[model samples]
Structures are given as C-alpha cells and as structure tokens.
Target: ERFRQVIWPGNSTTVPKGWEIPTNGKKLIVGVPMKKGFFDFVEVKRRSINNAETILSGYSIDVFEAALKKLPYSVIPKYVYLKSPVNYD
Candidate 1:
C-alpha cells in the first residue's frame, strides 16, 4: 500500500503515521548550483563525456556539504545549475 508523508520544516523527529520515518536519521535532498567563476562559490568543468555524468567540485560546495553532514539528521544534496544571475525579488 502507498502512504503519504508530510515533513514539517525544522521538525525532524515528529511525523504523521503511515509515513516511513527515518529511524537513524532523515535523508534530505538539497539543491546546489554548479557554475564556474574565479570568485564564485561553486565551479563546474564543461566537458564532453557521458550525458548522464557531470563533473563538478568546488571549495564552497564542499564546505557546505560538510556542514550538512555534521547536522543531527542525514542530508542528501541534489545539485542544480543556475546558468544566469539569481534574482532576489
């Protein structure tokens, strides 16, 4: 049977019934942008390889991921690309 689970932000332990709560910890998926810039936080190497594969690594992303790992709950990051400038508005 299929069950619906609703997760409240900042609430780690408590969850509705029928939801497969994380016994050890929660697995969170965070989005990250991979853009190349000399002073930017994350950088990506544009190369022609497997279409399903992407090459990305940087100091800022590494540190951020590390911090997330240190949290009490488990966090899984999902990187997203931001090609253009970010609009705050």
Candidate 2:
C-alpha cells in the first residue's frame, strides 16, 4: 500500500512541495575533497597515463555508496574531485 503511494502519488496538491523528483536526466554531483594526507578516509586517483580517468575510494565513499543502495529510488551520483583548502564559509 505504501509502495503504491510512492510510485503514483495521487492528489499532487496534498503532497508537500520541494520533494519533487527532477524530470530531466541529470546525475547528482558529489564533491569529494582531494586530501594530501589521510587517504584511508577518502582517496581520489587517476588511472590513465594522461590522467583522464579518475577513481574515488575510501571508507567514507564506501559508507556513502552503501546508504545510496538502501534508497527506494535510483540516484546516480557523479563524484568530482575538489582541491584542498575547500572553504565551506
């Protein structure tokens, strides 16, 4: 019963705004910091000789991927490498 509501959310007015899924085909972008130290937490590597291919791995990434797998809907994520000295503020 609950699954039906998720698949076909009737009465769009009753549903709260801001939770709508994007219709356009776009993958979610995830920014991962490129750290000089602490590679265990998160590590970004380039496999190709020309540095065209990139790989992301580590404990943090593993946990994130696990969580994504549990979600009811599919969420494609593109991990981008963020240079060090990232400023949140």
- In terms of TM-score, the best-performing candidate is 2
For residues 1-89, could you state the per-residue lDDT of candidate 2 as single tens digits?
A: 35454433564635545324656778889989986888999899999999999988899999999998787677778887788965656
User: What TM-score does structure 1 among the candidates reach?
Assistant: 0.51
lDDT (CA) for every model shown?
Answer: 0.60, 0.79
Q: Which tens-of-lDDT digit does each residue in 1-89 have in candidate 1?
A: 98666566666557534324356554455455543355366676656666466666777877987897676654555666556556424
Model 2 — which ten-residue stretch has the worst lDDT? 1-10
| Residue 72 error, candidate 2, Å | 0.2
Please give each candidate's TM-score.
0.51, 0.72
